[model samples]
Structures are given as structure tokens and as C-alpha cells.
Target chain A: MDPARRLGPAQIDVVAQLGVSTVLLGGIYALVSVGLTLIFGIMRVVNFAHGEFLMLGMYVAFWAYTLLALDPYVVLFVSIPLFFGIGVLTYVLVMRGVIHASHNVQIFTTVGLSTALQNAALVAWTGDYRTVRPWHSAVVIRALGMAFNLSQVVAFAIAVALTLVLFAFMKWTHTGRVMRATAQDHDAATLMGIDTDKVYRLTFAIGIACVGAAGVLVSPLYAAYPTAGLQFVLLAYVVVVLGGLGDMLGAMLGSLIVAAVEVVGSYFFGVAWKEVFYFVLFIAVLVLRPAGLFGQRGAETLGV
Target chain B: MPALAPGRWVAVALFGIVALVPAGVRDAYLLDSVILILLWGALSAAWNVAGGYAGQVSLGHAAFFGIGAYSAALMTARFQQSPWLGLMLGVALSIVAGGVIGYLSNRLRGPYFALSTIAFSQVLLIVASRWRGFTAGSEGIPVPFRPGFWTLGLGHVAWVYLALGVAVLYYGVAIWLETSRVGYQLAGVREDEDAAEALGIASRRLKVYAVTLSAAMTSVVGTFWAQYVGFVDPFYVFSIDLSVRFALNTIIGGIGTGLGPFLGSLLITSLETYLRATFSGMKTGFAGIYLVIYGTALILVVRFVPEGLTGLAARLRVRSSRAHA
Candidate 1:
């Protein structure tokens, strides 16, 4: 590499650090986007309130930690099932109503749900930025000539593990197969004796569960606030779109790409322009290729 | 105009009552609330042009609104220009921005278009906050309180009249669009873009026109907002919350109807005012409780009454007529 382009030892170490952190960030992004993508893929309905669900999970963890003095990692077990049930309930109460409505109705229903949930949280939690300060939150480990936050590393490990588990479940399990069939073709799945509605509910629950897991993992790294999910949700939208809407593997890949862009772009152009850079990229991708890297043909026009 | 219908007379009577509100109500707070209601009514009506009639839901309308606010504020502050001139310039800029966003994102359907609008608005927000030289960054620019007829400092009553005038103008445009050939083409495009395009409706061009008109009208409201408030901040001017409010008002009032946005704005503003008054003394985050209500109300409205208040009224009117028959 040219000396100007080549990084010195210290600079290389910084790059390595950035790379590791970005991967960790990508893991979290993938976890968030996976659920969002899954919901869109199967139901063809974008869950605008998806981030609010993540926020709900964070609050679950927060309340557990505050009231019971439980570790956030420990609270994840409770939060995941709780979020799953919430998702199922939301589907039963709200999603089922708008499932067959016009595109605009579907969009606004979620948007409305999102606005409601976010404000409900604001009313309940008072918009305070609460964080779980476990002992490991501040701990940093040095490895490969670079330092990493212990909390971030643990979160990354959990995110990747959960993602793999989800992948395996979808690939090997009967319910997962049925869900996939439903996603591929709802009418066909219905004809094949699969309860498509049940599958949708389950899929939505599982998607929300993924967000709950992500929220638990991220609790130590970020604050729990009413609007905390807004930024992450926007990023998840970018990741899911970039990965090709409704493609799990693509969402994972897209998450990494987005994380890398954020980390590297922030490093290069400054933090303020990081979103600007990616949003421009998002618009470009939409304009140039509506169907993302891994999306099915005509998927962009599917719901419409 | 042809002989005015009884409903038109009723509308005229309503306008007469609204025009006399300032004289009857001397409370500054009450006057301010009414002005806000009028402003929101105008804004929502503007949004309805693109979102309701054209079926292009723009969640980033705050970008145009903020652009208008900033342009007007900057012109008045930096160059000591007349606000009316600045207002015109701001509307022009907003229309151009709207045209660009419309052209670029016109290919996207539904949620994708909404997402692009959001991204665009966020980008503008970041730029407005960072470009401190022009925007004064987050500290914001103040519109010098030049209290004159031309300078738009003619007291709260004058502002109410100005806002009401703008609201009426916007409502007129909306009604005109609803009844015109362009309106039919936009509706066709909204109903089925492929079918409309096949029918040679020039869907993209129609959308661009709708969005440009919507943006220009919204920018006019933005200018009035700047003058009324005498201050402009990027966060307030370009907030996604503002965009949501516009959509919510329209949706709640009734989408695609001439009187929907006005009724929606009135309901929401009155509800907000009432909630704030009742909860003014509460210490436990009661301030945001109304928003929670708004959100819940939005979901409920979309679920059971998607056509909103106007739809319900129409249904009721039809039912009454049937009963009479």
C-alpha cells in the first residue's frame, strides 16, 4: 500500500479496533433487522412500531433490573417470552385488522401503533435515559493488539449465537418450514393445510422476540429511553432494505455493511455525517435497485 | 360561482363565527391556541394534497417546512427583507425541494416512498444543524419582532386573521383539486398507478405537481409559523414529529375529503389544549400523556374509522336521508 494510504502500527491498531467494534455493532444491527425483515418477508407488512418493541424490551430489562435487582443478561430470558407474547397480542388485536387493508392503511396502522407505543412509554417512563451499569459494562479486554469493551463483546457473542439458532430453527424445524412456506406463498401454504394466520402470528412473535434479545444485549451499551428505538429502528430499516427486504441472510450481511459504513464513515467524515452518508446510500440503492441485494424479483411491488 | 348551497351558507356562517373569535375572546392564550389550530389545519390540508389525493405519503414534509422556515427567517434576519417577499422565496425553495424529492422517490411505492422522505428529512436536519453559518446551527435564528402590518407584527388578532386567511386559501385549493380534472388524474394514479399510466395519465408528472403544490402550501404555512412564533430552530422546524402531526391530523379528520384536515386539526388542537389545561399541574410526565392519547386515538381511528370524522359524518347524513325516505 502507498505510505499515504498505508496505516502505521498505531493507526492499524485503531483500524483493527474499529473493525471489531463495527462487527459487534453489526451483530446487534443484524439481530434488530432480522426480526423486522422476517415480519416484512412473511407478512408483507412493515412493522413501523418494531423499534418501539425494542424499546419495550429495554424497559422490561430496566424494570427487572431496578425492581428485582436482576442482571440484564438474566432478564433477557423473561423479556424475550414477554415480548413474544406482546407481539402475538399485537397481531391478534391490531395486525389482523389491517392485514387485508390498502397499502396506505397498513402503513399508517403501524405508524400509529409506533406513535402510540413510543408516547405510552414516554408517559410511563418519563423519557429518562436509564442504563444498566453491570460491573462488566466498563470492563475492557485487550486482544490482538486492540482493546474491546467486555459488554460489547458479550452482546456480540449472544447476538451471533441467537442468529445462528434462529437460522437453524428456520432450516430444520417443521414449524419453521411451515412459516417459510407461508412466507413464500400464503395461498399455497393455506392449500397445503398450513394455518397461515397462525404462522404469521408465530413469525411476528419470533421477530419481536429477536428484538427483545437485542434490547437485552444492548441495554448495557445504550440507554433506555422513549425515543431510544427511533435511531436503531431507522438503521434497521436501512439494514433490512440494503440486505434485500425480507432476506435473513441478506439482512445479516447488510447489517455488517451498514455498521462498517457507520464506523468507517464516522472515522473519516466525522460522526455527524455518518447518517447522511448512509441515508444517501439508502436513497441511491432504492432509486437504482428497488429489489435489494437478496430480495426476490418484484418484491418491491409485492404488497402494492 | 353558481348559487351557493345551504351547506356553503353553513360553512360561511362557521367562517364568520371564526373571524369574530378574536373580538369575542381577548385571552391571549385562547387566541394563540386558535391560531395554532388554524396553522395545523392549513398544514394538514397541504399534506392532504399529496398524501390523501395523490397517495404519496411523505413522512419527511418537515424538510420542506423547515426549509421554508429557515429561508424566511434568514432572509428577514440577514438581508432585512420584507417577510412577504421572504415568504414567497421560501415557498419557491420548498416547491423545488419537493419537486426533487418527488422526482427521485416517485419510483418507490407506498412505504418505500415514505422511508425515502424520512431519510431526506433526516439529511436536511443534519445539514441544518451542522451548517451553522447559514442556519445559526441549533441555536436558531430569531425573526426580529417588527410589529407592523407589512412586517406581520400586527398583534395576535392580526395573526389569527392571517392564519385563517391562509387556512381558507389552502382549503380552497384542496377543494378545487378535489373537484378538478387534475384531481381525477391524481385519484386515478392513487387508485392504480400501472392502470393510470397505461391510461396515459403521466403518473410521475401528476405526482410531482401534487407534491410541489403541497410543499409550496406547507411552506407558506411554515413562513407564517416563523412570523407567528418570531423564532426558528432546526429541531422544531424539521422535526419528524411535525410531519407525523400533519399526517395524524389529516387521517383523523378524514383523508381525501375537502373538510377532513380542517376538522382533524380542530379536534386534535382542542383535545391537546384541553389535556394541557387539565394536566397543567401534574408532575408525573402528564405533559406527554396527550401524545399517548393521540397515538392510541390514531390506531383506533385507522382501525375502526379509517375514513375518519368526515366519513362518519357522511355516513350519518346518508343514514338520516334514508330514514326520512
Candidate 2:
């Protein structure tokens, strides 16, 4: 609250530097959040286990790089099909039974799944923080007096590319359209001869795979610990809500805003209280626009 | 007294079993385990008041728990006041906080409500962690042992008695709400908010009332927990894990079912404590084996017995009665 402690003339470049770093961090957050929103949008199920899958994905990359000598970038591709299979299996075995259950039941189901995965990781990895040191681990590019980690740039680029591909798939592909139709109205889509169940399965698979890929992408950047994904998971939830629960574009935009606020807030208010600033923002958004910035006017009340 | 109901008889029997645990088992470790069951069960029962009965699922209920622990913990640590005084003060504090949160989530549903609750709790957690001067931050506040009924600084066996009495009182409140007029109204609101509103149930007001009362009850137990542990920290008391545990216990037991939370707490907490004890001294990698099994069990429960143990028991009773007939 002090004037001297507030932004001064010399802090502009530092702000710019923080802003640049945030964009890269935001991209990774967007990738994870998009997957979460997709599942929520299509199935009307909030996947609490989502971060665990991401956590496992990071472990997959870490183990692969450590054990098999495969590069993390390569593991990003290798882990997708595996994660897709896991996602579909999860849907078939667990989600199928509770798809129509009460919201309370659905929430608990995911909560249970989340705990199981988190603890499973704890058991396997022994809570040691491991990081993947790929070939380009130390590569940094400096330009205009600001430095960017090469790996971060790669993640950002890939995230942007994936967002475009997802947009296109939803726009052009028949399966994508069917998925969209199911999301719009499950009953109508079922009536219109679309295999709504299959669509749900595919949407969940794609959604999980997306976050799994994000895990691989971030494996090089952050430590792969038992609870690492939890840190990101809470932030992803804040981002997903900020972007409008089921909106993809909104998720991306919200990520940048969240990332920027987090960076600046931490820089100013101290890192320990970084979450307070955005959580305050998150609460304000909920109070003012429950539907979120990009959400439909009445969408907040629509979820089953 | 009014005619004793069958359900009350079952509750009485369950309490009898719980109260007998300390008497039968003198192993301090085992007694601690049962004591946890009572504490967590009682807290989850409070959660069930709003979350299960009113269908307002909160992931931030630990904020109230933390608030209660701190209110009393701070009072005792700072002023050397009696914890009994802290307990009453915590209840008052939690009611206002929970009421405001309940009111905020009045229009929000599903993820919005869940997210709002998470934010509210995280805000408290951050404040508690950063406001080191007041809270002592993450190092935590340790309450000195001042043994007496007023201070609640009792020895181990006394803790068992105290915890059971509190648990019974909590479960009693839950049973009362289950049969009370307000309980039925809350059930109506939970089943269908729109219909309940149409019937002039004042659903919003009832929800606020439920959450506030639930929070107050949880805070009472929080004070008891602080005294029992003799230490309180921002991280342990206010963590998201604690909030999730309350919800998980309620759901695992049978949300809105009066006897469900206790049954859930008894089963899950006992198993968890047993697991941790068994797995604790194991070599490095095997430390979490118990938790892994426990979490998998949770998944299976949600998968097959989504309605919880009470619902399963009800179904079995119906089947057996039909066969007998």
C-alpha cells in the first residue's frame, strides 16, 4: 500500500521482462487448462484426477528419459497414444458407470481417482523431485535485452499450433462436429443419430491426451515430483474458471492473464502470497460474472 | 422422552462401540487412531449438514476448520486464555465466515461454487502463511500442556473420552437435522432447487443457514483437535487436502444420511491410520503403500457404491427382508 513500494519509473523494463516470461508460462498453463475445459464442456464431468494424469505424464517423460535414454521431446509423441488409451480405459471402466449419477457422486469419483493417482506416484517415485535434462537443457536465446529459454519457446510454439489444430478439428471434422453437437445438447445429439457415447469417450480421450502432452512438454522445465501436478492443477482450475468453464479460446486468454498477474503479483507482494492476488481476482470474477468473461450469459447455471 | 426411533437405537449402538474402543484397547497408538475417527467423523458430519443435506458441495470447508483451530490456538498461545473460551469464540467466527461464503455461492453451481470455495480457503491459507507475526506462519503454534477440563489439555485416555462425547454430540445434531423440519426442507432444496423455491422454501436462506451451522460445528471439533495435538500450523490445518478429506469422508459414508459420515469416518480414518502405521517404518520407496491402497479403495467405492456404505446397507436390508417375506 506504500507509494514508494509501488511501481516506479525504473521498473518498466523489469515488468516487460516478467511479462515475456509470463507469456511462456501462460502457454503451458493454456495447454493444460484446455484439456480440462474440453472434458467439462463435453461430458459435464469435472475431472479432478486431471492433474494426476498430467503428473503421471511428467513421470512418463522423466522415466523414459532416465531409463530409456529417449529425449523428452520424443517422449511427448510416444506418451500420447499411451495416455489416450489410459483416458479411454478410464472412461470405460470408471466414468461410464457414474456419467449419469448425481453431481456429488461424479465429483467424489474424480476426487477418489485423483487421490489414487497422486498416492500411486508417491509410492513409485519416493517423493524425489526429478527433472529431465534434455540435450537443449541449457539453451537460452537473448534478444532485445530479454532472454527466452529455447525449450519454453518451443512449448509456446507447439501450444499455439495445437490450439489452431483443435480449433480446426472442431470446425471442419465430422467427429469434431459431432462432439460439439453432443456438448450443445446430449439428448438432441442422441436423437440426431450421433453416437453420443462414442463422442464422449473420444472427447475425454483427446482431453486427457492434451494434458498428458503438456506434461511431457513441461517435464524439462519443472521438477517431476509426486505433487508437482497439484501445483499446476490448482492454477489450471483458476485459469479454466477465469476463461469461462468450457471455452477453449477463453482458456488460453485466461492463462495469459493469470500468468501475468501471478508473476507481477509475486514480484510485488512476495511469492508466498502470489496466489492471493489471483484468487482474489478469481473470486471477483465469480461474483461479478459467474459465467466467466467468455462464457454464455446463463452458462453458469447450465451444468448438470 | 419421545419414543426411541429405530435409527436412534442404531446410533446409540454405534456410539457404544466407538466409546468402548478406548476401554478395550490400551495401546496408545491404537487409541490415537480411534480418536481420529471420532474427530474426522464428527467434522464430516458437520460438512454433511450443508454439503450432503443441502447439496452445496464445498471444497473449502477446511477454512472453517483452520479458522476454529487458529481462533482457539491463537487465543491460548497469545493470551494464555482457556481453550474453552477459544472454542466458543471460534464458533462465532466460523458462522459469519461460512455464512458469507454460503451467500456468495448462492447463484453459482458446480465448478463455480467449488472454485469460489477453493479461492476463499486459499486466501485464508496465504494470509495465515504470510501473516507470520500473528499466526507464526508455517512453523505453527504449539499449545503448552495445561492439563484440566477448562483448558482441554487432557492426557491420552481423557482425549478419547472427550473426542467421543464431542463426536456423539455432532452425530446427534446431524440425526436431529435428518428428522427435523429444516432437514426435510434442506432435502427438498437438495433434490430440486427450483421446485423447492417454487414451494417457497427460501432455499438460499436455508443454504446459508446450513453452511453456517456446519462450519460452526466443524470449528468446535477443530478446537478439540488443536488441544489433542497440542500444536497448530497454517499448512496442516488449512490445507486443501484436509478439506478434500472431509468431503471424501462424507461421500464415502453417505452424504445426507445421518449415520453415514460417522460410519465413513470410522472406516476410512481407521484404515488410513492403520495403513500409515504399517507403512511408515517400511524402507524408503514403500512408505506410501498404504495410501496407494487406500486411494484405490476410494476409487472402487465411488465406482461400485456411489451411494456409500449406508446405501449399500439399505439395499442389502431390502433384499434380505424380501427374501424372508
Candidate 3:
């Protein structure tokens, strides 16, 4: 009757399944956090409405699927572009005014934006949870003697592909270089005749587009609701900070770490405590390394 | 700090009207709305202590509010203890929680600090919901209705007075802090932490004090809210929407001013009531249309009237004075 004897092969298999699932879940988180990191990197403004944007993406996919009979995967093109345009409009109309404002103004402006978007969605769509469960939504694929949701696997693949594409774009594109330079030193970038304002607008758009993409990918697996963004955005913040604020690769890595912690910790402490676990981790990371695991020194002090 | 100013008399007159007007109004709906306005006014003022004066925008104040509520509700429901005692305990616990949050987050400026606070509250919320043995889970704890003086039951009129008293107490504290040397140091910290540190002000300690004071007051307001509703639930009390509403009221009324939070609460509550009445007939989605308007108004206020209604009033006064000259 030794407690150690109770640990069996079945339990180990369960743990292994959890690990694989965590990695897949982390890919989706990485996709969401990457854009958040990019926006924060270039412009020091934390978009509190970032989650709302994801919610918008989900709704877009949901509606397109429901109305146009489009697949969730196919709706990414429309959602991404729509969200990009919305992002650009937000930057132009709202965020631009507060770029030079005080921290209080900046924080509340975005907070206000988040409130408006969330409530407007609630008003427009009601609080009903809508999901697009196309065929193959529940298909299970066995890989390496483990079962995986086919939809989740596809979403994971898309997430990784998008991240790679973004990395390449940032590396090879002139616009990406300009964004990095602006993020490094706004004054210096402007001195070099780079349009920092345009860079900021684009960075915000791209950041939002990333979340929009995530929304489309997630619609098959999850329900879309007005407050859905609130749930994901918190985890995105955790991922962004854990990876190091404004560090792209760090965010991707951080997402996996957070996902692992979430899955493994939930197994031990029950599912309800998962959010508590990550939030504690977030505070600990913030206290121990405010610059984040991959962020540059003194990044935490920027734009504060 | 002047004596017998015309503005002071007007304020005194306004206070007198608010305190005595409830006695004449017998409509339950009107009384309830007034009570809510007073409650929100106190809550927003409490938030303004750390947010407006100290310049640390906390997006997770619902933690302290929920803590205060749950403590009072649980104590009253389980132990049959007086809610007043529970209120005191809640205040103490919230101050401690505030100190912890401040100590952990004071190093972080702006949005980082705000997010940390949100995370902290979210942790508390999860604990509140999961620890069903203590909090009754999401079903929430209900305070047994006892019509007695010790239970602080004195009818709706009495409740109005109680809420008004708390709001006045918060207003008095805010005014005092505004004029005190500590207030100046907090303002310094808000304006620029580095500059404040260089001026020999201990920014961390000061911020902790500000947050603690704010939490203490916020907890009291939570206790009142729980008592008013006769229930306490994790989602109802610890909601991020509640936290956002606190900030919205303060910002709309005028942050860092004595009358700002109160005025903001009055305007917002009235608008909410009016909108609910008008839009209640709509079948779907109309429930939150008021909130949409509120949100848009909040954005507009932040964008154009950063100083809030008080600032706008001051501007008008200066304009008239110059025109007369």
C-alpha cells in the first residue's frame, strides 16, 4: 500500500498527453502574445483593448462561417485584414492623441477603449457564446501513440508557420528594421528620417492582426463571446512578460513555458487554480525581472 | 484654505440638500439609486487616493473590495457577528493586501503596475470562487436578514445617511490629503518617481501608504455594498468591470480633485439609470447599450477633458473672469 507504488504507467501516459497538449496550446498563446509584444516594443503603450481585438477576430470568423459558410481557417484572410484596418484606425484616431500624454491618460484611454469595444460587442451580439464547429472539429489524430485533437494540431501548425513568417518578415523587411529602430530609440529613429509615427501605426496594426489570426484559429476549439478576449488577454500579458516585453522569440518560448505550467499545475492543483498559478508567476517574474526573460535591461522604465 | 468663501457655502448647501433630500423622497427606486450613487462616490474617491494622487493606476481594486465584502458577509453569516466589526476587520485585511500589492508592484510604473494589480485581483477572484467552503463558491454568501439596530438596519432612509456619511468621510480624507505634506509627496511621486526620489521622498513607502489608505476606504465601501445587497459573490464583488467603473467615475468627474469622484458618480449613475429605463424594452443586446455609451463617453472625456468636469468648470470660471476684466 505504499503511495509510491500507486504511480502507474497510465498516470505517466496521462502526464505525457498533458505535455503534448500543453505544447499545442502554447503555440496559440505564442501567436497572440507575439503581436502584443511587438506593439509594446515599438510603442510603449499597452493596449488594454488587445483582448477585445481578439474577440473581434473571433466574431468575424464566427459570423463569416455562420453567414458565408466559410471555414475558420479560410476566414483568417478577412479577419486579419479587417483587424489590421481597425488597428490602424484606432492608432490614428485614439492612440495618437495620447502618445505624449501622461501614464494615467494613456492607461485610462486604452482602458476606456477596452470597455467600449467589449460593451459595444455585448450590445451588438448579446453575451451569447458562439462557436463554429465545422466538420472534423472533434477528429482525433494519433501521433507517437498519443491522441491529439486534429483541429488543435492544425491550429498549432498555423501558429508556428505564422510566427516563422513574422520572424522572417521582421528580419528581411525594411519596414521591420524601421520598427526595431523606433523601438530602440524613437528620437534616434526620427533623426534618421524614419517615419516613427507610421511605424507605430503599422506595429499596432500588425500586433492586432496577430491576435485576429489567433482568434480565427481558436474559433474552432473555443466559444466566441464578448468577454472572451478578457480571458485570453491576461494569459497573453503573462506570456509577453515571461518572454520579456518586446522580445519576439522570448514571447514564443514564454508561451510554451506558461502553457506547460498551466497544464502541469492544473493536474496537481485542480483546474480552477490554473489562473492563480500563472498570475502568481507573472507577479514573481515582474518583481524578479521586470525587463522579462528576454527583454533588454531598462526596458521596464521606458515610457513610464 | 480660505474661510467663508462663496464656493464653500455652495458646497455646504449642496451637502445639506443631499443629506436632507432623501427624507422627503419615499420612492424606493429613487432612494436605491441615490444610495448607489453615494456608494459609488465613496468607492471612486477611495480609488482616487492611489490612482489620482499617487498616480498608480490600479486596475484590480476589486480585490480589496471583494475581500472587504466577503469578510463582512462571511463573518455575519457564519458567526452572527456585527458587520461593523467585520467592516473593521475587512479594512485591516485590505490595508495589508494593499501593502503587499504596492510593495510588489511599486517598482513597476504605469501599465505594468496596472496589469500586476489585475493579476493580483484575478488570483484572489479564483481563490474566492474555488474555496467554496469559505466563500460558498460562485453561489455566494448571503447575509441573513435581521431587522435590528445592531445589524445596522434602519430602513432605506437610514441607509442613505450611512452611505452619505461614508462618502463625506472619504471626501474629507481626500481633501485633507490634498493639503497635507504627504499629499504633496504623493503628487510628486505621481508626477515623476525619479524626481520624487531625488527630492528625498521615499516613493516606495509613500506609494504603499497611499495604496493602503485607499484600500482601507475601499473595503469599507465594499462592506456597505454587501450589506446593501445582502449578498456577496466572487463575480459580483471581484469583477474587473467594477474596477473599471471606479476608474471611469473618478476620471469623468475629475481626477485628483475633491469633488471629482462624487460628481462623476452622480452623473454616471444617473446616466446609467436613465439609459436602463429607456432601453430596457429592447429584447437583446440592449442590456449593455448604456455601458457602450458610458465607455464612449469615458474615451471622449479622457481625450478632450483630461482634467474632468472640475477642470472644465475651473476653465469656464477663468474665462468669465478674464472677460469681465
Interface RMSD of 2: 2.0
* lDDT (tens digit, per residue) of candidate 1 on A24-87: 9999999999999999888888888899988888888888888999888898888888889988
List the candidates ranked by DockQ, beginning with the highest: 3, 1, 2
Candidate 3 stretches greater than 4 Å from native: A1-12, A302-304, B4-10
Candidate 2 docking quality: incorrect, acceptable, medium or high: medium
Off by over 4 Å in 2: A1-12, B1-5, B18-26, B285-287
Clashes of each: 0, 0, 0
How accurate locally is residue A301 in candidate 2, as Cα lDDT from 0 to 100? 75
Clashing pairs in 2: none
Those runs of model 1 whose alpha carbons end farther than 4 Å from true positions after fitting are: A1-7, B1-10
Q: How well is candidate 1 docked (DockQ)?
A: 0.66
Clashing pairs in 1: none
Model 3, span A1-304: residue lDDT tens: 5667568766678878998989999999999899998888788888888999889988998999899999988888777788899889999988998887776788888888888899899988989999989886879898666898888999999998998899888978988888899988899999999988899899988998899999999999989999999989999999998888888999999999899989989889988888888998999998888888877766666644
lDDT (tens digit, per residue) of candidate 1 on B1-325:
6886443454567567779999889999989988999999999999999899988898989988887788788888988888888889988898888898788557777788888888888888889898888778889999998878777777889889998898888878877887788888899988888899999999999999999889998898888899889899888888878899999999999998767898899899999999988986886777788888888888889889989998887789899999999
Q: What is the TM-score of chain A alone in each candidate?
A: 0.96, 0.94, 0.95
Which candidate number maximizes DockQ?
3
Query: Which candidate order results from sorting by lDDT in descending order?
Result: 3, 1, 2
DockQ scores for all the models shown? Answer: 0.66, 0.62, 0.73
